[model samples]
Target: MENDEMIIPELNNETIESMIYIIRGQKVILDFELAKIYGYETKRFNEQVKNNINKFPERYRFQLNKEELDIILRPKKSTLAKRILKNI
Candidate 1:
């Protein structure tokens, strides 16, 4: 089978900019935000990543530590989990 490059959808500049944040002193966007920008369901996006794991570097993804999660989750007036559920 001939290999074909997958085309990533164009993202709105403002929308993409807004999703970027500094976490652990590194600029990043959550998997969910990236999936949204790429017009994918978060679960499917993640599954694709797993299937093509070698395509991404270690720094490309990391789980939030407890302290980091607390710092982020605490400030949000609303529960992030609920917000995520509503969107999906």
Candidate 2:
């Protein structure tokens, strides 16, 4: 079958790679990234997560520490700061 016939949606390699990195044994997504993907604002994404804290266990979701945040945002800023600041 041709490549276009593949069942998986066609995504750019960078996006696929980012997904792989994000899903590395953890259900985590930065607020900005999740907002972009879900078509919501970053603040709204954080509000939902906060409202449904139980739905997001540590394994499913958690905020990054300053060091961790530094690592993630060093290359580029992420809206995760909103939640991280609150969680801390």
Candidate 3:
């Protein structure tokens, strides 16, 4: 596959479950997690989603506000997670 092409990743239930979080009373996966699952850089994944906005319904996508971002980042105990979040 080309570098820009996405793989049809086979995600196990445990892997998917680990990525899902309850935010705003809705189950959600962070964009970075989705990027990892589908073999794209987070920025590229977002670009693809925006370019093909019609493919994803409103319920499938939303931006994180500062508070929501905090909520997602706050519980993370890993320095790597913090660094990744900050860089992204």
Candidate 4:
């Protein structure tokens, strides 16, 4: 294998089950995790999904409360909100 090569894991029941996360009573799979299963970079995977975002019934969306928004808009340079805000 070359330095740039990747080894895709087998998607058996256990592997898929391990990727599923339960948050707030809802099952979720992060896009980066899903992209890894198919051997695609996260940006490429997201671009493809963005082209057809509404096609899937299981697509997830969430709304932040006022307190959540306030935290995300904090002006500290080292805060995690910079990355989180970009994704929002």
Give the per-residue lDDT of model 1 (tens digit) for 14-71: 7678667789889888777776656666777888899999998888888788777666
- How many clashes does each candidate structure show, in the order listed? 0, 0, 0, 0
Each model's C-alpha lDDT?
Answer: 0.70, 0.59, 0.76, 0.58
Ten consecutive residues with minimal summed lDDT in candidate 1?
A: 1-10
Q: Please provide, for model 2 over 2-84, each residue's C-alpha lDDT reduced to its tens digit, 9 standing for 90 to 100.
A: 12232334546677557433434564657666555565556776788899988877676766677765776555555545544
State the lDDT of candidate 4 residue by residue for 1-88, as single tens digits.
1123344557778878865655556776656556666666667767768787786445384434676446434543364455444444
The C-alpha stretches of model 3 lying farther than 4 A from their native spots are 1-11, 77-87
TM-score for each of the candidates: 0.68, 0.56, 0.76, 0.52
Task: Give the candidate number with the greatest TM-score.
Answer: 3
What's the ranking of the predictions by lDDT, best on top? 3, 1, 2, 4
Q: Which RMSD values do the candidates have, in order?
A: 5.6, 9.2, 3.3, 7.6
Clashing pairs in 3: none
lDDT-better candidate, 1 vs 3 = 3
Task: Name the runs in model 1 displaced over 4 angstroms.
Answer: 1-11, 74-80, 86-88
| Top-scoring candidate (lDDT) | 3
